[model samples]
Structures are given as C-alpha cells and as structure tokens.
Target chain A: MIELRDVHKAFGSNRVLRGVNLTIPGGTSMVIIGGSGTGKSVALKSILGLVKPDSGTILLDGEDVAKAERDAFLARFGMLFQGGALFDSLTVWQNVAFRLLRGSLKRPIEEARAIAVEKLRRVGLKPEVADLFPAELSGGMQKRVGLARAIAAEPEIIFFDEPTTGLDPIMAGVINELIREIVTEMGATAMTITHDMSSVRAIADHVAMLHDGVIQWTGPVADMDASGDPYLDQFIHGRAEGPIEAVR
Target chain B: MIALAPLAAVGRSTLAMLGTIGSVALYAAITLGHILRPPFYIREFFSALLTIGYFSLPVVGLTTLFTGGALALQIFSGGARFNAESVVPQIVAIGIVRELGPVLTGLMVAGRVSAAIAAEIATMKVTEQLDALVTLSTNPIKYLTVPRVLAATIALPFLAAVGDIIGIMGGYLVGVTRLDFNAAVYLRNTVDFLETADVVSGLVKAAVFGFIVALMGCYHGMNSGRGAQGVGRATTNAVVSSSILILASNYLLTELFF
Candidate 1:
C-alpha cells in the first residue's frame, strides 16, 4: 500500500500542492484525474520523491519512503512517464536492459540483451526491433518500449504518468489494456495519473479526482459516474460549463 | 529617470544571474557528494571517457593546432619592433596549455557533448525514459550523470595535453617553415621552457572544465521545463554555461597557479 499524508509543496509564491492526502491499497489500480495545472503531476512526483514535498510523509508498504535509503526505496517502484522517456543514444534493447546491465544487478551483456529482447517481445515487439534506437521507432512503439523498460525489473509498485496523453484513441486503448494486463498479472500496486476516461474505465479499480491540490472525490471506478462532486463531474465529462470554471 | 530605470534593470538582472550561479554551485556540490558515496556506475564512467575524451580528440587537436600557428605568427609580428621574435615558441606553448587548450576544448565539447547529453536526457525526462530507469531499480544519477561526469573529468586533461602538444608542434611547424626559426632550436626551447607545473595546471583545468560541462548538461536536462521549448532551452543553457564557466575558471586557475 502507498499512503501520502498532508503533502504540501510551493514554488516561490505559487502553492502547487496544498496539504493533499491519499492512500492506495496493494494489488489495486488507482487513477488520478484532474485538469491541466491542477497539481496531479506534482502530487505524483511528490510520491516518487522526484519533487520533495515541503512537509509531508509518503509511506510505501507502511514504511516512510521519503526517509528510506533513496536507491533501495526507488528499487521497489516502476514509473512510466507521460513522455515515454526513451534514451535516444541507446538502442531499444539497451534502454530496456539499462538497469539489468549495471551495478549490483550487472549481468553479462549477452544475457542482459537477451532479457531485453524477451521483454520487447512481451510488449508485442519483434526481436529484430531490439537493435534499433528509440528515434527509429514510432510513437506507439516508443511507448511500448517505455512500458517494457518499466516492467523489466518487475517492480512491486508501479506509477504511470499521463500514460495515454499523446497517443491516438486506438493506441491509447491498446496501452490501457497492456497496463491492465501487467498490473493484474504482476499483482503490483499501481497508481496512474490520466484524464482519459476510457483509460479509467479500462484500467482503474478506483478513481481519485485532484482539484485545488486535494482529492475532491474518491470511489470505485463504477461509482465515478455518480461521484456527485461538482468538480469531479465537471472534470470527468470535461464539460466546458460547470461549477468548476474552465479558467482559474 | 530613464537612466535610473536602466540601472535598476541591470541591478535586477545581476541579482538574478547571481542566484543562478549560486544554484549551480549548490547543484555541483550535491552531485560531487553523491559521486563520493556508494552505487558508483563504473560502466557509464568508461563509456563517458570514450565519448567525451576519445571521440573529442580530432576536433581539439585540430583547433589547437591552427590556433597555435596563428598565435606564433601574431606574436612574431608583434615582437619584430623589439627584435624579440625568439619569444614565439614559449608564448605559443604557454598560451596553448594555459588558455586555448582547455577553454577551446571545453567550448567545443560543450557545443557537441553538452547539447547532446542535455537533449538526450531532457527528451528522456519529457518522454519518460528517466522515470523508466527509476522504475527498473536504477538511480538515474548513477546511470546517467556518473558516467558523463567521470568521463569528462578523466578525458578532458588528456585532450588538453594532446592539444598542448599538437599546438606547440603547430607553432614549431609554422616557425620553422614560415618564420625562419631553426627547427632543432625551436624544439629545444619548447622542451626546456615547458615545466611540469605548467602542464599539470592545464590538465587540472581540463578536468575541472570537464566536470562543469557534464554537470551542467545533466542538471539542466533533469530540471528542464515542459515540451520542446524547455528541452531546447536546457540544451542551449548547458552549452553556454559550461563554456562560460570553463573560461572563467581557466582565468582563476591561471591566477592561482602563476
């Protein structure tokens, strides 16, 4: 389980996160939904320690991850960035196998490359494609490569940031299905941030709406349609006219 | 009032620039601290050496060679008034080792490597590659910054030394062929005048400059803003800041050593 307690963050005069708190039980998918600049990404970054919260505690499996030894704490989590963050200089296999081939996890180059190829194959990519660079792949393939790299280590916890942002609806659905498959298969605790309703329907066990730096609504995915909160209603439907104004 | 406004603007900009410099210094110290601790990435270090040092040789060698030749001609012509042409070889050697070798090599590498590292990492940050590394149980700093910084620091001095040698040779070639200096005497003068301290100082400068270049690239890329413009800005900043720091540090080191 992952728990965030009263997280606060500010940049100069701008308060991006204002004492936000939330929790996710293990072996479940929690999707955070929010509008642009609504602190969704900031909230996720805080959980991951990418952005240190001013005063808050993030607990993973009931232990304070923020206070834990960074590398060991980091070792348990996998994150799929919204941008697909592929290393352009390395080939697809090398990128996927990056961690496996270095430090205490070091494997022979051939063994690591083989595992990279297998992971690529798991994501519906051909063996031959592993030799190619990230730039050589299409957007969808890049995302798939990113996904493969994320799960390569089979992390206990997974975070997906705007997973379906730039893809076409068809590709988005495919990615959503793949994410669902991986979370279910691994039984990993998953937290995903996305405004894609279809993704919420496809992958989420529960949905949390972040607005004004706090979770405005939280419930099972089925209850999201009847969430009743004006902000949640306005955001889920992406309605132009609602209690939540289009502009701040 | 107009003059006052401009002065106020200048003062504000200066303060902002100072803030940036302070942050960079802080970032450098933190990275160095991490570097000293455990989880060092040795593979990345070797790879960086190959990329920053070995690959950069041709350009540094060529730039110093040409610059040395030109400096020799300029010094010889300037010295003609006092018939002090004998100073050409010594000046070329010192100038190449102290200034041109490190600064030009740093600038060139910054132009080539800094932008490349920043763009690659910023694109990763934007694209989710760095997050992927984190997920795979990898520290991005250990994986990314360690190798690049280690490579640049270790490789740069060798490049400077090579540049130093190549530059003096360039001056020697120019002196013997164009300036009518005897080849044997020019070689002897260069060897006799070049001290261990002079060479070591330049190498140390190269190492410092290398660290600056790689660190700037990683820092900007990791903290870069969103979208295309942010990555672009990071890349530009990395190159410009690295180059400027190299030149500025070169001056300070020179003063300290001399």
Candidate 2:
C-alpha cells in the first residue's frame, strides 16, 4: 500500500501541493486526474523522491519511503516517464534489460538480451525491434518500449506518467489495454497520472481529481459522472464553461 | 555617477557568477559524498572509459601533434634571434612534456567529453530519465557520475602520456626536417632535457584535470533546469568551466612542482 499524508511543497512563494492526502491500497490501480500545473506530477515526483516535498510522509507498505534508503526503496517500484525517456545511446534491448545487466541483479549479456526480447514481446514488440535505437522508433513504439522497460524487473509497484499522451486514438487504446492487462496480470499496485479520460476509464480502479493543490473529489469509475464537484465535472468533460478558469 | 554605474554592474555580475560557482561546488561535493556511499555501479565505469577515453583519443592526438609542430616553429624563430636555434628540440620536448601535453589534451577532452556528458545527462534530466533511474533503485550518481570520474582519472593520464610522445615526435619531425638539426643531436637534447618529474607532473595534472572535467559535467548536468535553454546553458557551463579549471589548475600545478 502507498499512503501520503498532508503533503506540502512550495517553491519560494509558489505553492504546488498544499496539504494533500492520498492512499492507494495494494493490488489496485489508482489514477490521479489534474490539469497541467495542478501538482499531480509534483505529487508523483514527491513519492518517487525526485521532488522532495517541503513536508510530507510517503509511506510504502507502512515504511516512510520519503526518508527510506532510496535505492532499496526504489528497487520495489518501476516507472514509465511521460516522454518515454529511453537512453538515446542504447539499443532497445539494452534499455529494457538495463537493470538486469548491472549491479547486484546482473545477468549474462546473452541472457539479459533474451529476457529483454521476451519483455519486448510482452509489450507487443517484435524481437527485431530490440536492436533498434529509440530514435529509430515511432512515438507509439517508444511508448511500448518504455512499457517493456518498466516491467522488465517485474516491480511490485508501478507509476505511469501520462502513459497514453501522444499516441493516436487507436494506439492510445491499445496502450491503455496493455497497461490494464499488465497491472491486473501482475497484480501490482499502480498509480497513473493523466488528463486522458478514456485512459482513466480504461485503467483506473479509482480516480482522484486534483484541483487548487488538493484532491477535489475521488471515487470509483462509476461515481465519476456524478462527482458533483464542478472542478471535477469541468475537468472530466473538458468544458470551457465551468467554475475553473480557462487560461487564454 | 557613470563610473559608479559600471562598477556596480561589474560587482553584481561578479557576485552572480560567484554564486553560480558556489552552487556548482556544493553540488559536486554532495555528489562525491554520495559516491563514497554504497551502490557503486561498476558497469558504468567501463562505459565512461569508452566514452571519455577511448572515444577521445583521435581528437587529443591530433591536437597535440599540431600544437607540437606549431610550438617548434615559434620556438625556432625566437631562438634564431639570439643564435640559439639549437635549443629548439630540447625546448619543444620540455614544453610539451611539462605543460602543453597535459594541458592541451585536458582542454581538448574537456571540450569534447564534458560537453557530451553534460548535454546527455542534462537531456536525461529534462526528459525524466534520471528520475526513472532513481525510481529503479539506482543512484544516478553511482550509475552516471562515479563511473565517468573513475574512468577519466584512470584513462586521462595515459592519454596525456601518449599525447606527450606524439607531441615530441611532432617537434622531432619539424626539428630534423625543417630546422636543419641533426636527428641524433635533436633526439639527445630532447631526451637530456626531459626529467622524470616533468612527465610525472604532466600526468598528475591530467588526473586532476580529468576529475575537474567529469565533476563539472556531472554537476551542471544533474542540477540542470527545465527545458532546452536550461540544458543548453548547462552544456556551455560544463565545457567552459572544465576548460578554465584545467588551465587554472595547470598553472597552479606547474608553479607548485617547478
């Protein structure tokens, strides 16, 4: 289980996260929905210890992960960055099997490459694609490669930052299905941040709406349409006319 | 009032630059501290050697060769003014081994390797790859910086030594062919003038300059700000700082040893 209690973050006078609280139980997928600059990324980064919050307790399985031995704490989780930030210098297989080829978890080069291929296949990528560099791949291919890398170690917890952002609608749906299948099949606890409603519906077991630096509303997918909070409503429908101000 | 305005501008700019330098120093210290802690990545060491040393040979070699040739010409012409042209080979060998070989090679590698490491890491920072590494139970410093530092430290001195040999050969080519000096005499003077301390001192400078280059690259890259402009600035800062530090430290080392 992941638990965040009364988190606060501020950069000078600009407060990004203000007294936020959240919890995601084990064996479930929780998605946070928020517009750009609404602190969803900051909240996620705080959990990953990328952006240290001014004050907060990020607990993982009852241990405060924010202050935990970072490498050991991080060993249990995998992440898919928004941009599919594969190492430009490495081949696709190398990127996927990066963790397995180094440090305490290293395998033989051939073995690591084979496992990378298997993981690539799991993400619907061909074995031939393994030798290609990230620059040679299309956006959708890169996303799939990113997915393959994220699950390469079969981490217990996974974070997906805008998993389906730049893909075409068809590719996006495919990715959503892939994420859903992976999360369910692995029985891993997952947290995804996205503004894509279709993705939230496809992948989230629970949806939390972040607005004004706090969670405005949160519930099951069924309760989403009737969230009743105008901010949540405004975000879901992506309506121009609402309580939320539309930036020019 | 006008004089004071210029002075105030200079003062403010100096303070800002100092502040920037201080932050880089602080970041480098923290990174070094982290390196001494656990979770060292040995694989990255080989990778950095491949990146900083193996990949940098051609450029360093060429720079040293040309610099040696140029130095020979200038020294020969100056020596001729006092009927001292026979000093060419000895002066060239000493000059290259004592100062130019290490300093020029360091500056060249700094220009090539530091910018590359900084730009790559800065791009990783902007693209969230570094964050992904952190999430994967990897200390980015161990995975990234330590390896480069170790590789450069081990590899750069060897490279500098090679540059020293090639640089002397360059002077030999010019001295024997262009300056009408006997080959045997030029070789003897070159050998006679170069002491062990000179070469060792150059190698030591290479080691320090290598650390500075990698440290500056990793520091700026790790602390890079958001977006393209931030990365651009970091790349520029890494190259410029590494070069300046190389030259400055070279002078200090020269003064200390000589």
**Which runs in model 1 stand beyond 4 Å of their true positions?**
A103-111, B1-11
The backbone clash count of each candidate, in order, is: 6, 0
Clashing pairs in 1: A78-B135, A83-B127, A84-B127, A85-B127, A85-B128, A85-B129
Candidate maximizing DockQ: 2
Q: Model 1, range A96-199, lDDT digits (tens) per residue?
A: 88778775567899999999898898888999999999889988998898888888777888888888988999999999999999999999999999888999
Candidate 2's residue-wise lDDT over B1-258, tens digit each? 987998999999999999988987777787678767776766678888988898889998899998888889999999989998888998899899988999998999989999988999999999988987777667788788888887888888988999999999888888888888899998998998888998899999999999999988988899788999999999999999999999889889888998
Cα-based lDDT at residue B187, candidate 2: 91
Model 2: TM-score, first chain: 0.98
Query: What is every candidate's C-alpha DockQ against the true complex, given to 2 decimals?
Result: 0.56, 0.71
lDDT accuracy of residue B188 in candidate 1: 87
For candidate 2, the clash count comes to 0
Tens-digit per-residue lDDT, B129-240, candidate 1: 6766665667787678877887888888898889988988889999999999999999888888888888888889989999999999998898788899999999999998
